[model samples]
Target chain A: MTLFPRAVNETTSRELRKTFRSPSEIFYPLIFFVLVLTMFPFSIPPVPGLFNSIASGILWTAALLAISLSLETLFKADYSSGALEVIHLSGANLVLVAIGKSLGHWIISGLPIALLAFPIGWALDLNFLTLWVLVITLMLGSATMSLTGSSISALTVGLRGGGFLLVMLSLPFFVPLLIFGSSAATNASLGIVPEAELYFLGGMFVLSLTVAPWATAHAIKIRLG
Target chain B: MSKPILEVTNISLSRAQKLVVRDLSFSVSGGEILRLSGSNGSGKTTILRALAGLILPDNGKVARLEEKLGNITTSSNSVIYIAHRHGLEENLSPLENLNFLSQVCTPPPIRDGVSVLETLGLKTSMHVPTARLSAGQKQRISLARLLMFDAPLWLLDEPFTALDTSSKKQLESMIDAHLDRKGAVVLATHQRFNCKSHVLKHSLPMIP
Candidate 1:
């Protein structure tokens, strides 16, 4: 096999193993996501139509926050511990490393949130078709979030108060994703196909997939310097 | 003497807007050990990083030479750099970390992870998480990369820190063995250690 795929495989597997070993890394964001979704119903009045009407917004917002929370430490540990330097010096392509890290983040954070949104949507009285649309939109939107967040995380890897900085820098980029993802779900709830919103999310995913890893590699280099 | 594997010419490096290395120039060839010695803030690490291609020189060039069909060609895979921080994950075992590193290495590692750990006297603790390992043991695990990868140029930054006497001696011998294979080393350290090769000391003047 060529070097790129092999390097990506090792990096992704290492990332997966590290995530698994630290239960809190996986659980904290997940718990935050669940809690945020769970508390929304209690905070709002007991209007059945209101809950269903706002379910898509609440679920997407929770996912976005949970992802941002998890992204705070995405590159911090690796950068401070010198793992990033070693990998870069080892002749492994940093672009591939970025891809692997984003993939791992999507698996742990994005995938779980997407799957869990189904049950949460059910609890919120969303219909079957809308729940599926929520899951699908989240799967695409969260992966894009992970990609965009990876670059920002690398940019702010070692700065003081970088967590808050990451959330701020990333939030602007995430607005479009949030708009389309929630709109898609909301339209699906109203028996609309939501094709345009889905297409937009898909386009953003492909665009970020192509650009984010390269940007992340450069960001890491700059931070290391 | 073999052709120079690395050359840094008139390189001026600045960290955080202050120049740390000013027009510094050096080169390392096969079977040579270039020791960078200086007091704190003298830019030994900066110079080493410049040589490793991690930091670009504002005024000069850093080049790595490779022999391709009897001609010297510039290449990147010639250097292996070990920074101050041990790159092993806190949660992963030494074996797992080494395995991951080996896979990422361009040319696959000649020596397996287990044998390299055994050579470093870390066989028993290879399965334990690196966070539980003592400083010296963790340092040994980081140094294990020397034996695993066959990169011709090794750039080590403060590699002697936290290493016990025996481990330091072992590292010196490893340097000797690597020199025996006609490989070059550019090391930055404060500790005194002996190697069989003729060591060239380059002191970076403290930036005022």
Candidate 2:
């Protein structure tokens, strides 16, 4: 109804439309995530115990890479088309638009990985409790990854070899999420509650959700300047 | 003239690690059209960007008159900027692109989207993706953005490129009509245009 909400909705709808229009953009990374998960059992022993021991690590690492893979398209089209400049000039709050785009990205790239973690974890012989912890942790970690990755992607949108730059810039931020996430699942397997790790991951998610959009807005401004 | 709608005072800008616009200054009053003419790499686009607040000046400031309160404002909300790039999503149809622009526009769109595209002579291809359109059509689609919003100042960079004679004249008339409504425009282009409004040609000195 109002400008801010309408602008955010418009941005989100455009992103969703773009993502679905070319479904490959959404499927490739997810397939990569699944393939990476599937490869772990063959490389290591095929034993159920061995598979369960390393399942969380494989999922987190693959999800991280998959999410990173999708980040390249986050702002590439808009920036190249000069739509970002037009939006900026139109007086739309860049922060809200950034958040909306990030949300669309999470839905396409992050949410699927998180939802698949359960079934994939089962295929890797993870128990019910560990599977639940894996799913919860992946959901939080993936959302946080998308948020932080959006910022890094925005910062690198104007640069050459930006994909490499995005990974380099985002890895440090991803480290904490990976640590807390994998540990939460591992702890759950070991009969520990993993509450503290989940809390830490949630805190990181909230913190990133707060800061990444603003940082993304600032990054885009600098790029345009 | 009632307080220049937009003012650039002693502003300087750099591109590719070199100063492009050096202490350049100009102002655009209501019902006036300021054309930025210069040779290649003369920073015409840079000056328009500075006026739009997309680029911060290395020195001095750009100010704009707020029509309601009669006070000078430097915020970006007062200006409408059309970059050299078409700014339309290649995957979207012309109508969809205008709808995209309408969401964030200041005064917002009261007119139907189809009529606006028709007025821009894009009625036939209104539903076709912009990527399939010709260069002139894309430029016309970008020009259609001007009608989606109502801002006191317009910063257009190289607006006439790829346009045929008739479309060029049509756009020139649109700019003239905008000027007649007491809106100001700072346009950067080499194409010569004749309009009834006060036309001032400011040339940028080439980088030494």
Provide TM-scores for the models: 0.93, 0.92
Q: Which RMSD does model 2 reach against the true structure?
A: 3.0
Q: Report the lDDT of model 2 for residue A87.
A: 74
Chain B alone, TM-score, model 1:
0.92
Model 1: per-residue lDDT, tens digit, B129-156?
Answer: 8889999898889888788877888999
Provide per-model DockQ scores. 0.56, 0.56
The C-alpha stretches of model 2 lying farther than 4 A from their native spots are A1-4, A38-49, B67-77, B110-112
Which digits, one per residue and each the tens of the lDDT, describe model 1 over residues A1-225? 255487677777888898788787677878999888888878999976887788899999999999988897678788888988877777667888898899888889899989999987898789888999999999999999999899999999989888999999999999999999999998999999899999999999999999999999889878876
Residues B119-167 of candidate 2 have per-residue lDDT tens digits of 9888899989788999998998888767766677888888899999999
What is the Å distance of residue B145 in model 1 from its true position? 1.3
Reference contacts reproduced by model 1: 0.71
User: A143-176 in candidate 2: lDDT tens per residue?
Assistant: 8988888888988996888888888888887998
